[model samples]
Target: MRFVLAIVAFVVAVVLVGLGIAQRTVFHESAKNNLTVELDQANPFVVVGPDALTAHPGTQTVSVSGSADVYVAYGRTADMNAWLGDVPRTLVSYNKDKDRLTTAGTAGVYATRSPSPAPQRKDGSATDAPSTAAPTASVAPAATSAPGTSVANVPSPVGSDLWLNELTGQQLVTTTLSLTSGISLLISGNGGSVMPSKLTLSWPVDSRTPLAGPFILGGIIMFVAGLVLLLVGFLHFRRSRGPRRGRPRGLRGLLHVPPRPAKDVTSTGEARSGRRRRVAVSVSALLLLSGCSPDYWPSPASTEPAIETPDATAPVADPAASAAPKPGDLQVEPAVTVPQMERIMQRVSEFAATVDSSRDAKAAEQRFTGPALANRVANYTIRGTLTSQPAPPPIPASPLTLTLPQQVTDWPRAVLTIAKDSAAPTVAPMALVLVQDSPRTNYRIEYTMSLAPDAQVPEVAPASIGAAPISPEFKGLVLPTGQVGAAYADILTSGDASKWYNSFHTGGDQLVQQLGVEGQNTVRSGLPKTASIEFTTRVTANPILALATNNAGALVALALQQEETVTPNDGGTTGFQTGAVAAALSGFTGKSSKGVQRVTSIQLLFYVPSVSTTSAKVRLLGWSESLIGASELK
Candidate 1:
C-alpha cells in the first residue's frame, strides 16, 4: 500500500512540474502590445492626439518610418492645433474596440477675426472652445507648385518654440514618452514637404504567472515525500523477510543473547538510514518553500467578513456644500506653457551671452526689440570706444522667480518674467517684458529693467491661468497706463511741486533720489560758469504694455526720452568731459561750437493700484536708462 501511494505521488508530482514549466514557456503572453498604421494618403504633417498616446496606462513607444528625415514633437494640444492653422494634415487615433490605429484627413481653420472673449460658467470658472471643429479632406498639393500657393508649403515644425519636447532622426525615429492628458504629438519630414507614411505605437504588458512557482514548489515537495515513503516501505519489506525467524525469535526470547538474533544489526542500521532520509526530505522541502514570494502563489479568499471602519479624518458629506469647480474653469491658457517659457529663456540667454562676448549689436536685434534693442546697441557702441566701460548686465536664464503670461489666442502675445543670477549675488534681478508678434517669429525682449532691491511684487494670476492684457487707456487703475510714464517724469523733474507728485509712492524710489530736483541742482552747481544746462523729458512713441494683477491693479511698462542740453552762457564753446560716454556716442572730437546734447532712454515699470483701493498709488518697481543718442546741437 505504501509503494502504491508513493507511485501515485510520483505521478502527480511529474504532472504538476510539467504543467508549471509549460505555463512559463509556451503558454506565456507577449511582453508588449503593438499597433501600426499605414496612411492611405500622405499629408505634409501628422497629428497624434493625446487620447491615442495615452490609450494604454503606461509609457508609449512611438516609431515612424518612410521618410528621409523624420521629426516628432509634443506640445499642448491647443498649441499644436494653432500652429497647424490652415495647413492640411492627418490625424492619428486609436480604436480601442478594434485594437488598432485609425487615420483621418483634416485641415485646420485660419480665422482672420480676433479671438473671442473667454467664456465663463455661472460659477465663474473659464472654458475654451476646440480649435479644430471637424475632419476635412486632405488639401495637400498633388504636385510641386509655387511655394506660397500650396498649403503643403507650410513652415516646418522643426525648431518651433511651441514644442515642449521633440525628437528627430534620419529615415526612421523611435522614442518613448510618458505623457498626460491634453498633450499631443506632431510628426513631419524635413522641409515640411513629405510626411512619414508609417507609424507604430507600443505599450508594455504584465506577463507574470501567479501559479507557476507554487505548482513547481509543490511538485518538489511531493517528489521528496514519495522517495521517503518508497524507502521506508522497502526497509519494512526487508525486515519482514529477515531469516524467517519464528524459531530464532522463540530462542532469543528465552535467552535474548542466544545468538542475539545476529544482533539485528542490519535492521537497526536500516532504521537509522530511513530516519536520515526523512530528515533530508524535510530539509529539501523547507529550502524550496523559502525561495517563493506571495506573488508566486494564488491569493486565498477570506472566509471572515471584512469589517468596515470609519476613518476619523475623512470629511462627511454636507447636503448644502457647493460642488468643487472643474479644472480650467475661469482660467484661460497662457500664451506659452511653463516648460516652453524655460526653453525660450535658455535660448535667449545663450544668444545674449554670445552677443555680450562679441559685442555684436547687429546680432542682438534678432532677440531684442524697441527700447531693449536700442539700449543694447548703444551700450555696444559705447563699449567699442570705451573699452574700460562695463557691459550691460547679463540676462540669466535659470531660476525664474515670476512668470506672468498674457491670456490670448491670437497672433500678438506678451509675457512678463523676472530672472535672477545665482552666480552674481550682487547683481539685481532683471524684469523682462517679452513679446511675440506672430506665430512664425520668436519672442523678443521688449523691455529689460533692473528691479529695485527692496521692491515688493504684487500678487498676480498663476502661470497656468494667465492674466488678461490691459489696454493703455484702462481706467480700473488710479492712473491710466498710457499716462504713467509722463506722470512719473513730472515727479522726477518738479519733485513735490508736480501735480502728479502725490499720486506716486516716492519713499523708496532710487530713480527719484538720483535724477530728481536735488540731483539736478547738484549737477547744475558743478557746471562751469561759461556753460548753461537745460533738462527736458517727454514720452516716446513705444507701445505701453500692461497686464492685470490679482488686486485689480495693473503692471505697466513704458519708455521715456530725457534730453540734457549744454551750451555756452555767453557764446563760449562747451564740450563733454574727456572720454565721456556721451562724447563717444556723439562722435564729438573737441568743444562744440554750437552745443552738446545727450538723450537718455528710460524704461519704467510701475504697479498702479485700482481706484477702488484706499490710498491707491503708483509704485515704481524697476527702471533702466541708456544713453541711446547724443550729438552736437545744430
Candidate 2:
C-alpha cells in the first residue's frame, strides 16, 4: 500500500509542474477585440455614437486597426478649397486675455506713437521734449538703457507662439479619442471624420500577465518536491519487505536498502542497511516536501503601471511622444467682441470674395446654413444656366437692421433686411437672418427673405437682448402663432374663393391687385385671346415661422407659388423670344417651342406679419420673391 501511495504522489507532482509551465506561458499571451462604429458629421466636427469599450484587467498591449473615408459636406467643399488657397493662421495666447502677454520689460508695444529720439543738443545735452513724428508700428523699439526706460530682452507676443494657429487635423483627431486605463497595446490617433463616414476599430484583448516568474517557479518546485516524496516513500516500503538487495534497479534501486531485517544481515552489512532504510527514506521524503517554498511562486501583478524611475542598468521606454490629443480637454465658451451681425458679415465678405460660387461655392457655407445655403446654391446654378453673365448680388454698402444688438435667447439670432434701389427692376433687397445655437458655434445664416416696397416689418426686441422664439401654438396674438403661416397659406389657396376672404384687405397693401383674381387674368390676358387661361396659386407646404413681437404681434414669414398656364384654342404656340414674360420665365422653356406654354412661377420669400389686435386684418409687411424655378413641361 505504501509503495502504491508513493508512486501516485510522484506522478501527481510531475503533472503539477507541467501545469505551472503551461500556465506561465499561456497566461502571458496577449488577446484582441474588434470594434466598428458609424460616424456622423455636423461640419468641422465628428461625433462617435456607439458605447465605449472596456479592456480586460491586467497589463496588455492594445493595437487599433481600421480604414475610413470622409467626404466634404454639401457647401463645405469650398471652405476646404479656401484652406488650400490662403489658409488662415492660428492665434493662440498663453491665456484668454490676449492683452496680458508680458514681454521684455516693456508695458506693451501698443503706444500710439513712438517718441522721436531726443535731439542732440549743444554741450552734448539731449532735449527734454520728444520729437514729433507720424505713428508707425514698424518703428524700432527704443533701447532699454535709455533714461526712464525699463525693458527685458524677451520676444514680443506676436513673435512668440501666441499668433500661430495649427491647421493640422492630426492633433484634433487624436485629442478626440480616449481609452480605459491599464490596458496594454499600441494605440494610434483615432478621431474626426469628413461627415457621414464609416470607421472600423480593432484592438487586442484578453491579455493578462498577473503571475510573475517566481510564482511559476514556486509551483514547479512544489511539484518536484511532491515527486521526490513519493519516490522515497515507495523505496522505503520495498526495503522493509526484506527482498534481495545489492544495487537496486536504476535510480530507484540506488535509493533502496538491503531487503532483509537487521537480525538477518549479510557479511557485507546490507541487511543492517535495510533495517535502517525505512527511517532514512522517511526523513528524506519529509525534507523534499519542505523544500518546495512560496518564494519560488510568482507574485500578483500591480494595478496600474507606475512611472518607472531612471536606473543605470534597466532598459528605458522610448522617448517618442504620445501624439494623440489629450482626451476630454475642456474649452471655455468664446465671446464675440464684435457685434454678432458684423461677425456674420465678415464671414460673408470672406466667402463672397474667395469662393468659386459658380463652380464650388463652399465659402458661402460659413455664412449660410439650412435653407439659406440650399437657396444660394440653387440660385447660383439657375443664374448660370439662364444668363450669359450672371452676377451674384453685390453686398450692400451698409447693414440694414432694426436693432443694434439683435435678439438674445438660448440661441442668439439676428434678422437683417438689406435693400437698395437698383437700375435693374427685378432686383430687390435680401433679408438675411443669422442664428447662433450655442456659445461655441458661430452664427450661421438660417433663413432669408426678399422684400418688396409695400412689405412691412414688425417690431422686434433689440440685439442687446434677442427675442424668444415663440411656439406656433402660442395664442397671444389674435391669430395663434402657429395659425399665422396656415392663415396666409389659406388666403393664397382660395383668394376670393375662400370663405374667410373678407378677413383680408386686397386694396390696403395693393396685394389684392397683384395676388387677387385680376392679377392672374392680366398675365394671360397678353396670351392669345383664343387661349384659355387657368391660374392656380397656393401657399407653399413648407414651415411658416411666427417670431414673437414685443407688441404681442407675430412676425410671420410665409412662402407660396403662383402658376399661370395658357392653352390656345388655335394650334398656335407661345414663342420663347418675347416680352417681359421672357425674362421672368427665362429659366423655363415650357414644352419648348410649343403653343401650350406652361409657365410655372415659384415665388419663395415668405415673411409677412399679423397684428395682435382683435379684428385687425393680416398686415402685408414687405416681402421679396424670386423666380426659383421656371420649367416648361413637354
Highest-TM-score candidate? 1
Among these predictions, the greatest lDDT belongs to 1
Q: Across residues 390-458, which tens digit of lDDT does each residue of candidate 2 receive?
A: 544554323454422222211223344343434344656666555443222344555555565676666
**Consecutive 10-residue window with the lowest summed lDDT within model 1:** 306-315
Give candidate 2's whole-model lDDT. Answer: 0.39
lDDT of 1 by residue, 304-372 (tens): 221211111112221111222245443245777677788889988888888987998777866788889
TM-score on alpha carbons, each prediction: 0.78, 0.40
lDDT per model vs. reference: 0.75, 0.39
Off by over 4 Å in 2: 1-338, 349-393, 403-430, 435-447, 450-458, 489-497, 567-575, 578-615
